[model samples]
Target: MTHRLPVRVYYEDTDMGGIVYYANYLKYIERSRSTLVGELGLDQKKMKDEDAIVFVVVRVEADYLRPARLDDELEIVTTHHAASPMRWVFDQDVMRGDELLFRAKVTAVCMTTEGKPVRLPAELRAKLT
Candidate 1:
């Protein structure tokens, strides 16, 4: 399944040249992943507070294909799949209408707040698959 999130390129998202800062694309994709988790009925806060479990990004591979300027309306498209019991992978794209601006593959691992890796909760794993 795929998830879509709409985002607007605001003044704060841009650099001195008025184009989105490269780092901001990572932020945009992070928001898309967070939203996807919420839509899947996962409560990150609850997981953190009660189970002491949290998801942390372990790696990100990105490519910049085009630039996005301030005031541009963009959509983040994300598709997720499980990589292992403790790892989840997401492929994301940043688009302005039909134009692909950026793409990334992000890997996240389930971990304890103290930083030890852990298998994803059974319920959450079921939801992702």
Candidate 2:
């Protein structure tokens, strides 16, 4: 199943053309990822300070199809492409109603506080099921 997050485009998220600023799409995607982790009872700050591990984006590939305007109510769809002990790959799409504005294949690696890749924690990995 895909995780869906509701996003409302604000004026600050827009460009001079009044459409969403290009870079803000990345913000939307990251927010959904953070929410997904939170929903699974994983807190990045607590995990990092306590367990000494965190998740970091290792790769990002995106496609921009259409423009999302200010005040548009959109849905960010995130689906797990691969959820493993070492890393998680998510296929995410940003949409306004039935219209797709952008899509991305984002890869995040489980890492140590010092920035080396690490294995995913057992309980956290189970949530991908």
My TM-score estimates for the predictions, one after another, are 0.97, 0.95
User: What does candidate 2 score on TM?
Assistant: 0.95
Q: Which digits, one per residue and each the tens of the lDDT, describe model 1 over residues 1-129?
A: 799999999999999999999999999999999999998899999999999999999999999999999999999999998889989999999999999999999999999999999998898789877
Q: What is candidate 2's lDDT per residue for 90-114, written digit by digit as tens?
A: 9999999999999999999888889
Q: Local error of candidate 1 at 55, Å?
A: 0.3
Question: Where in model 1 is the C-alpha error above 4 Å?
Answer: none
Lowest summed lDDT across 10 adjacent residues in model 2 is found at: 120-129
What is the alpha-carbon lDDT of model 1 when measured against the actual structure? Answer: 0.95
